[model samples]
Target: MAQLQLGPPPQQQQRPAQPGQPGQPQQLSPQAPRPPQQARPARPATPSDTPPSGQPDASRDQRRRALPGETVAPAPDETVIAPPRQRITNPTAVFSGLDKITGRIIAFDVAIDETVQFGALQVTPRVCYTRPPTETPQTTTFVEVDEVTLNGEVRRIYSGWMFAASPGLSGVEHAVYDVWLTDCKQSAPVIPGQAQSQPPATR
Candidate 1:
């Protein structure tokens, strides 16, 4: 009975532990989640952005505040007004009257009479005549009095400068002649069967 060896069985007594040992809380092992860091897209508000208080930036204040009478629009080539010119009140006079034997007669006839108020201009009347070394040399001729027959009768006649005709046919009769009277503008009216041509002597 003294030969009973029990040394191998005594190794089972390695369990003597008891003093504040609570170790079981380290769980972080699902490591495939690293894709959530993409947050950067916020920049689109410019006109220099941040002008809502008194509201002023319409491209930096271009000077437009004038509402009292308001008249500012004339610069395309700028030329407001300048057009009204043509005025002549009394201007037309040519006179002469002396008839003891047809010596000098041109007393009044130079016409242009128009009155429209703003257009159709021409008002001529201011001519008191007679100035030409006159005493007697009769040969003066200038006739144009186109039509005046109510009882005063003076029908068409226009003949200028013939002064005492008869220098080669025995017709002698002369005095002191020097006549000049001119105020002219004529379109038509001198036809008395028209035929008196002789004008080609210029030297």
Candidate 2:
């Protein structure tokens, strides 16, 4: 019978590394690699996350700064207030007309609501306004003109504002007749038969 020999376990037996192969690299069993930590989803945005109202944005100021050799446009002024509109108070306006055939100039005063015949054109003063004595002298009149045809038909020809300072700027453009605003009056002329109103007593 051969003598019984004691030896180490087969798993612990070491194999000799081949020549010129230096040393054998250690083999390690791979662990499933923790399954990539499972990144948490980001929270959703809410109304509280919004910036406060009327607060200026930081990025806007940075963008407004001009770079080297770059042209920057000016921002519009939003606070420019417009002047208040004025009211018209006068009730009568004087209009001057020229007759081409007769070579004569005739001036007629028309009430704010009444119409006057200027040659073939009917002149009606709708509004008459005069600036205060403290302000620059200016008179504006809104006039309406109508023409009558041979067949007894009436038609509107011109309806617009005429300035006293610049009479030629807005006036009737006609071949036989021309009309323009000249002055503004407080009251219309009293007729021959109509009774004149008494002036108010001094306070």
Candidate 3:
């Protein structure tokens, strides 16, 4: 049989302090390895953010500047002038007469200030003008027409300008006849033993 020895339930082994200062921290036990603390990442700058100076980029200013020895074009002339339109004047004005009763259409020429009879109407041209062949054909005449009554009485019917291109706007209009200007020239051809314009039979 052995003798039992129980002084104090065996005491934990203590580490002896090899300390230097008075308020120094003492080691308790092996500390658990701490997780490494990660560093915060820095933010990147954006293009939309304006700089402190508020000035435009140097690259853009260089593009706007003119290069040396560059040639510049001149501006075009602004004012434009046109030549005048040419016209031709004639001594005689030619006309076409329509007889609604006889269904006859006859073309005749009349000299300026001369009176010519067409059916019961007398035509007198005051002025006639035309354009050159190279230009547009515009035959215009200032004329007067008189109507003769059955009782031998004469009265003015119409008097104004007439355009050949537009016959409906002519100066002469009668119940049985219509006269429109056709052309303007120096003279008309003379027929053998016949006058260019037939005179009205003696009343």
Per-candidate Cα lDDT values, in order, are 0.36, 0.77, 0.80
Q: Which candidate is the best by TM-score?
A: 3
List ranges where model 1 is wrong by over 4 Å.
1-90, 100-144, 147-154, 159-203
Off by over 4 Å in 3: 1-76, 188-203
lDDT of 3 by residue, 1-203 (tens): 99786553344235355456477665544586656799888665455556458787544455456477754332232244657888888899998999998899999889899899988989999999988888888989999999999999999999999998998886565789888888888775344467567768995
How far does residue 200 in candidate 1 sit from its true spot (Å)? 62
**Tens-digit lDDT track of model 1 for 64-166:** 6545687555533347784543322223333232333556553443333311110111113222222233332333223332333447664433223322232
Residue 63, model 1: lDDT of: 27
Q: Where is the poorest 10-residue window by lDDT in model 2? A: 71-80
Error of 3 at 189 (Å): 5.3
Q: TM-score of predicted model 1?
A: 0.17
Worst 10 residues of 3 by lDDT: 71-80
Q: Which should have the higher lDDT, number 1 or number 3?
A: 3
Q: What is the TM-score of each candidate against the true structure?
A: 0.17, 0.52, 0.55
The alpha-carbon deviation from the true structure for residue 25 of candidate 3, after best TM-score superposition, in angstroms, is: 62
Q: Which order, best to worst by lDDT? A: 3, 2, 1
